[model samples]
Target: MSPSDVSEADAANELMRLAKTIAKHNKLYHAEDTPEIADAEYDALVRRNNELEEAFPHLVREDSPNKLVGAAVAASPLSKVAHEQRMMSLDNGFSDEDIAEWLARVRRFLNLPEGEPVAVTAEDKIDGLSCSLRYERGALVLAATRGDGQIGEDVTANVRMIADIPQALSGETPDVFEIRGEVYMAKSDFDGLNARLMEEGKAEAVAKNVAFDPAKIRQFANPRNAAAGSLRQKDAKITAKRPLKFWAHGWGVASSVPGETAFDVMATIADWGLPLSPLVKRFETLEQMLDHYRHIETERADLPYDIDGVVYKVDRLDWQQRLGFVAKAPRWALAHKFPAEQAQTTLESIDIQVGRTGKLTPVGRLKPVTVGGVVVSNVTLHNRDEIERLGVRPGDRVLVQRAGDVIPQVAENLTRDEEREPYIFPDHCPKCNSEAVAEEGEVDVRCTGGLICPAQRFQRLAHFASRPALDIDGLGEKSIAEFIEAGFLESPADIFRLHQHRDAILARDGWQDKSVDNLLAAVETKRAANAARMLFGLGIRHIGAVSARDLMKKVTRLEEIGVLAEAIEAERSGIEKLPGEEEKKYRQRIDAAVSEVIAIDGVGAAVGHSLADFFHEPHNREVWKDLLKEVKPPDYIVETRDSAVAGKTVVFTGKLETMSRDEAKAQAEALGAKASGSVSAKTDLLVAGPGAGSKMKKAAELGIEVIDEAAWADIVKAAG
Candidate 1:
């Protein structure tokens, strides 16, 4: 329920509950470093707590979590280091308007006029554990983890193992310096570590003569957790095995001045063998800083390391000294954060979905909650094994994450104070009365009823007519369901034969004569379809629209793809049934075919396997042959038009206010232009927005045409 819907008494009760719950979570996150919930979900809890407090101020507790900055440091075996100068946090700004106001407030505090220029340096806020390193007389003295504002736990031995950390400074070193930065694990390294751990667990289990349990493996929730847990290892040797990296962003206490500006000091640190973020930029205007933030956001997924936001700090030391402290945060620095990618909500129930391939995947039906600005009511549980690993149950408060800044998934289930029953895996398919079975070494449980299953039938037909596929007009989820139930549609081929049901469709509720005509016209127009679209419409497992396009780029006709699939399957089967030397030749043949198919960008081994499996299956083969009888899709072809950007590569950066990035790319492609994400030497044109940063600068440096949305529109019109 919403805050406004709650009564005063209920609000007070909830406030008390939230206060206690948040306090526990704060201790778990800050002190223990073993958070039970995600950062986004914790933020939601705190936000809800604040809302409750606002609604019922009279019930404010003395032990409220909001009143504290950091929790008391938990006692550790390592010696503690008292900070000479307290390491404070930075306040967050979520939007450009908030950043503008923050800058204005900074100017006011510094007693500077509005016209006076204030330069700031922006750095990527690495999502990792913060550590402080002390150097004395050009030698590393100590290293400590930021336990609290005042003190930290010494981890000098662990720091000495990290190659990124400097053991001894160069000739131009400071007499006494303390540098602060984040210790993070790169995504690639993190994955490698997880894989190694799983292998080790399996090896150890084999020695002990027992089955390997996935729960026994040390699997981290994310890269940050992996880095933190690695750095805090009691044995420095173990820490060295974990691929931990560092980036020096700021400083704690310094005896001698290394540089006059923050930028210069960071440069000096970088020269001392400490890595710094390449995305860092020095800006003289608020627009530049905001632009850098936008650029960083767009490139977040591509970066080697994870970053929660960007930190902007006053470059001038004198100005920073003037704007000192605000309780627990620095007045000169601000962290501009992106939208929350995780949220907490009640798990109403668990539902099982049967995909087109008959794979039974569990989905979490969640109470409506907004995450990453999207209201999500359901999240993928992935598989039964994943469900067991999470240990989630109905009515549990689960933390849902928008993984990869995209698909919503249940990350964790916060164990409640009370006992609850574990969720049971279904033995039969939920949509159809068929036994569900899982093959040996396979994670997913699938229904045995193949195409006869109602669930698979609906899903396959819907996918065939989906926008990313054939894109049939007047055909949506509701219409497909209604038509299927009315016995008018059974197979994808039935869609092309819908002309025979014109009178019946017209007589149905909400169906008019014009709508029927339009639907039939749309279907008729798509009879001559593209190879990629028709292939995607088949809904083969692991064959998405992008992969279909990639496959078609190499093979023109659907028949050729089918033949390639058969050849690959034949080679693979022969290799699998034969032994060492005899199978080698067959394996080489399989590899040759796979290599050719995988040579096409975006097509991987899994896609190749799925394609082969689809063609090899008798039922699917029959369906393909039957469907081909009705629809004759055209061969893949490239049509280059006579336009200004016909053979040119164009790069787009920053927010496109008038149109979406996808729409802009589509429009560019429609004009025979190739839309590229990055600015390079090959880029002939760059479309820059109000907050365009590095891309715009690169375009100018490369002498590329940099145009705004309005100018892009004029060019499009001229090309037309």
Candidate 2:
């Protein structure tokens, strides 16, 4: 053959090969929980194939992987349902600003009046595979997975097993309706499944060196992967084996709907027995909606199901119709996603560290990986149980992901090496050489070294100076590490002694006089920090920021916390001897005391116990004593006449007159009134400055008082 002929044949074969490879990878990723390639690698392959197809349009084949959704539909017993409206996937937004831009484009296209408030309903965007169900006359007619935007495979029988998705709707039902939702496995459920696998001895054993070990059955990489695999099973019984849950997010189509508002429609759906995301909030304006998003982000870790981000939709049906559909997604709705929680990185080493509570935590040091733009080098292995379950050993290839964008954790071990040695739980603490014992009903094996462990000291110091703890500027993790390395700082009290070595630090390599001065200045600023900040900075095992604040509120003085801790401990010991009435009273008192100690909005029992334990510990008290000699924290402020918002319910709308919307909300929160989203009779003031939109009109119609941003500022100033 000629050179040109050979080249043509080679290109054709290459195209075919790429298509097959891409399709196989997609199957593994989307249907099987077993990804053959990393996301970056997969993206590169798709991009390359797209470029090739674009360059040679005539060569494109209908069955090419570039044109397909993913793998073929799973061989399930469920009858397939053809969708009335195709389940299209929405484009993702990575940041708040990205969402704002999307909203702006929608507004611009719709020619919405400037300064008109756009009411949006925000709900948790469940991290799971998308599925749609159709019901006719209250009875479920069809169930299908969102294969591609245009086509989907039916899985009616398999979906019927999901108890949360109602077989029929209640009351006056629509003639035809379509429900859209995500199918997911709870983290706890996933963990439990893995645990059961381990107990049953179905888990793969660690390989000896030079021997090949197969991948473990217990590991599913992530919840999304696990859920997808379960849903695609040939047997309905197999799908049922996985703890799958369905949460209704919205509707695709509805005939003869009774409600004027989307919320009303959702209420009907919830009444009909569809599980809805509990985090849904209806806001009157964009500001309130954003605030709700922030609140959800703050509380995301505590949620039962996984959420990638928040989804916002126009609350009013009329407005939604007015906005209409764009390309694949609706113009009236936008998905405002949180930063990516999962990331892939090369595992460098796995080291053990001791916590303040003396618990040994395995920390995996990785090649710095960026998730949601934050660099993460270290992730928690959780416990010895997790180590054994994952069959992860040092130097093995692993995937790291944050639990909920807060706590870093290892998601999977990708390399299937049977010869890899099993990680044995240490009998003694790696930090202090003290005996490590697993507590009853607990997974953590703790060291008995208490506060003396250097590793624990370093961890505590770093935690103490964190933003939510002491918030001491210039006293970051790097500075703490450097100080620890130089043997200049150890205990919490050592922070105040930095002045003693200011010259030495300044004289050291990579250090200058100005930097040294700044460090000392930051240390001085923290000396007068609030009681809550100080308490949190101490690095008590269970005492988190909220608990520290709660403790501070009840005790008023740092020293008084010790006494309260002792009293609580004594009361707890004598709980069995008390009369019913006395026990009730004692319980109330204890509850009140505990509440007061950790009364911050997000604080809980775990944090309270840590705080109590810290205060009661002789070593911690001794550290506190030594620390007090060098630096005294600010006096506790029990009562103040200044109101955060003076009991007034305030609503902010449109572009602010002076500060940004976020700044205005922060100011409002700092002052005292509940900053609300919508206009109602309960609303005291509607801050309608420049660009005030539908919220201003609604506020006026409802007879709720309205004020400008300047007026809102004045109110806050007066309260102060």
Candidate 3:
């Protein structure tokens, strides 16, 4: 509905709806590193909400997104830190008219004459995670994320590992200096990381005697996500491996200013062994500020790091302090954001791609169009609902967007002619011709063909040989695809039967005698795969590594899965099959068994149902029967240990001097304890480190026993 035709009640309802939507996007962008909407689309929503509120001032909601800076910090292994000075967001101006009005407002507020100069510093606003670094006596002390304006995640250990972040500042410095900036991964570095992941994946595929699938490589959605996920790692050693760089943009909670103006202070910061953006410029008028924004926009694609906008902050520190902030944003600074990169292209067709989980995703094939610096020919339609929302057709001219990552998306349908009909979403599995069903509360339509679909074969085989599953050394995705094409392997059972094709594999083009020997040897070693790994390798829907481990802990033998399957099938057929109390007893026993399976951490009803379904399938039963004949998987077992922390949940926090957090958790697990990642009522112990914060506090509040590193070491010795 148009804004002009809306009633006051509708406007109020829209405001509340927009508030919730914006808040959800904030969390997705800030905490999850996954944003559903582009920046331009988000801005448009905010603009519309603001306009509605303005039309009816009394209808302005108290929970309006305009009064918010950032999303609240999500739960993490990292301890939390409260900021000494709140981090504020900048007000945004999108167009020339918006910039002009902003300047006029600033002039009016400051009561400056028309000809008087208002020095502003225009700098590229880095599109990355915001961080604050505190230095005490020239030594780096603390580092944190800008979460919810007030509280943030303490990532000092990870931050120290960044090469650009100095352990000690050079030259003269304040007793307590705080440097605020952005942590970003350069485009080249991001590309290198993805390439390395792909190569590693390919190597693993070849090791498993399978064909490598480039599509199986894992990649971050964007460089910003790569930086955030790397920096927030529980293991600092892992963070150190990533290529991350920092650029100082401003300061917070400082003892004293380094220089008189923002520009001067930033210069001083650069002089003191800190990196600053070279595109930073000082402007004397609004026209110069706009020109600088334009210049930055033109050079954005060429810049090594991503930048969505240019920031114009008042140069004089005195004026900034005088202007202060208005709610969630500063009045002394403005962010001139560039419109999202979009291009008009003809959407030629939509194709369905089935995933390992049997879910179908619609992909749009489009006429090649250049967006940002990349040529995009394919875009994701997301789902059937999204297709209906866009009213898109095969011949429609759609607006495709390139935000981050290499994947393009159809942002809007520019339908000028009514000659084309709306695209019909598929009702049947495109590969297997099975009925495609969208389960309750699910956006994806999945095929019920189970092991029959040809498209799912490669993925299922890859999963069987994945690191978390069987951990086959030489097998990889590429070799699996090759083997499948050669008709040498069909199912997990066929993996063990690979020895029969030894001579055939040796005759292949890329096959070497030594490599083939190694691959066969790896397959032989996995014949005695651990029960948990064996269960995970089966590729049952909803059975992740952790869930498989948990389920194995409850049931010892592979045959127990078959027994449980029989019980569930009997119960489903009705207890009338049994007579009198036998029926009641059987029903009780089956319920107890199912409950035990569901009791495992991360295993819910969906997972339990999927497990039962797999076991009941006739084809799956035959496959399992064949697999069991070739491999005698060891029964799940827990060694008896005399330790205080045995069978207990232990949470580790802060920095450990003797060992990394990963090592500490590994040690805890070795002692028969569960190494949990968060604090909870079930936690029997908290392993507090040097800079332990929220976890320690919560443990104390809950009266959960807290032990330092020394005590933990003593416990380890005693357990040994």
Best by lDDT: 3
lDDT of 2 by residue, 26-83 (tens): 6665544455334434554655665565555445543455345544443334554556
lDDT order of candidates, top first? 3, 1, 2
TM-score of each: 0.48, 0.42, 0.56
Q: Order of candidates by TM-score, top first?
A: 3, 1, 2
lDDT of each: 0.77, 0.68, 0.81
lDDT of 1 by residue, 498-579 (tens): 8999999998999998998998999998888888899988877656565677788788887677777876687557655457
Q: Which 10-residue window of candidate 2 scores lowest in summed lDDT? A: 1-10
Clashes of 3: 23
Worst 10 residues of 1 by lDDT: 58-67
